[model samples]
Target: MGLLIGVGVLVLIALYFIGIYNSLVRARNEARNGWSQIDVQLKRRHDLIPNLVETVKGYAAHEKETLEAVIQARSAAVGAKTPGEAGKAEGMLGMALGNLFALSERYPDLKANENFLSLQEELSATENRIGFARQAYNDAATIYNNKREVFPANLISGGFEKAELFEIEIAAEREVPKVEF
Candidate 1:
């Protein structure tokens, strides 16, 4: 009777460990999926940059520096490896875009151009999607990080390191350029 009870307890412990391990695995996958979501948005933004730059080029022909800055920022964002690096690059891109939009205020024709307006709308929509994705990624990261650190989960998740916290890519200016005004 005593041997049977001891074996049952051991079996329960094994099952508990297995359950926690699975939970950790799920959380990690969620975080990864969230990162991929952010990646998609970033890629969309990158693809749109050249078109945006081209549209502005005709109107702001003299603003070579601003256009070059946008291009450089986009390149950096594309090459960024980690979340921290990506955040900084993304912020730089945001600043460059803000400058690009400011030029629109200087050129009424550019703002009124249908092609420019449509591109701006698409960029705006993508930015909104990126924001949503960031929120989701951060949420997933939070859950994963918490699970990794939590007592029982931590024991089971010992093999898996804690996931890094997701950074919110807020531009320094904190506001998207109101280029239309």
Candidate 2:
């Protein structure tokens, strides 16, 4: 009777560990999927940039520096391999795009052009999607990190490494400037 009781307790412990391990795996996969959603949106944004640049180029040929900066930022963003690298590159690209739009104000015709306006709108929507995806990714990462740090799970989580959040390091850029009319 003593041996049977010990075996039953051991089985329960094994099942508990398995359950925790599975939960961790699911959380990690959710985080990865969230990042993938961001990647899809980013790629869409990248694909639209060349068209945007070309449209602006037709009107603002003299703005070589701004156009080149946008192109270079786009390239860096597309080449980014990790989440941290991608976030930084994406921030730079956002700044470059902002400069390009600000320059567009000088060209009334470019602003009026239907193709340019359509592309700009599409890019804006994609940026929104990217924001949502980043939030989801961070949420997933937080859940996994918490699970890994919590009591019983922490004891078993030694075999698993903590997942990294898709964090943007560009604090200054993320802030909105106070614009008082």
Candidate 3:
């Protein structure tokens, strides 16, 4: 009877470890899927940029510096391999794109152009999607990180590394300032 009781307790401990391990695996995969969604949105945003730049180029020939900055930022963003690198590059691209748009305000005809308007709308929509994807990715990473750090799960997570959250390095770039007259 003593031996049987000891064996039963051992089995329960093994099962508990197995359950925790499985949960860790699932959480890690969820985080990867979340990052993949963000990557897809970023790719869409990158693809739309060239068309948008070209449309603006036709009207703002003298604004070569702004256009080149946008192109360079786009290249950096497209080349980023990791989430952190991508976040930084994307932030730079966003700033460059903002400057381009500000320059466009000077060109009345460019603002009125149908192609430009359509491309601008599409880019705006893609930016929104990217924002949502980033949030989801961060949420997934947080869940995985918490699980890895928790008591029982932490003991079982010896083999699994903590997932990194997608973070924006430039906090100032993330905010818009209000202008009061």
Each prediction's TM-score versus the true structure: 0.85, 0.83, 0.83
Candidate 3 lDDT, tens digit per residue, 12-116? 999998998899999999999998997798799899989998999899988999999999999999898886787788889888887877777789999999998
Maximum-TM-score candidate: 1
> What is each predicted model's overall lDDT from 0 to 1?
0.83, 0.81, 0.81
Model 3 residue 13 lDDT score: 96
**Residue 64 local lDDT, model 3:** 91
* lDDT score, candidate 2: 0.81
Q: How large an RMSD does model 3 have?
A: 3.2
Tens digits of per-residue lDDT, candidate 1, 1-181, equal 9999999999999999888888889988999999799789889989999999999998888899999999999999999998778888888988888888877887889989999999988887788888888789889989988888989776667688776655644663223444435
Residue 85 in candidate 1, Cα distance off native in Å:
3.9
The model with the greatest lDDT is: 1
Residues 1-181 of candidate 2 have per-residue lDDT tens digits of 9999999999999999999989988887887788788778889889989999999989999999999999999999899998678778878988888788877878899989999888877777776676787888899889989988998998878877887775644542232111100
Backbone clash pairs for candidate 1 read: none
Q: Which ten residues in a row have the lowest lDDT in candidate 3?
A: 172-181
> What residue pairs are clashing in model 2?
none
Off by over 4 Å in 1: 81-84, 167-170, 173-181
Residue 37 alpha-carbon offset, candidate 2, angstroms: 2.8
Candidate 3 segments exceeding 4 Å error:
81-87, 167-181
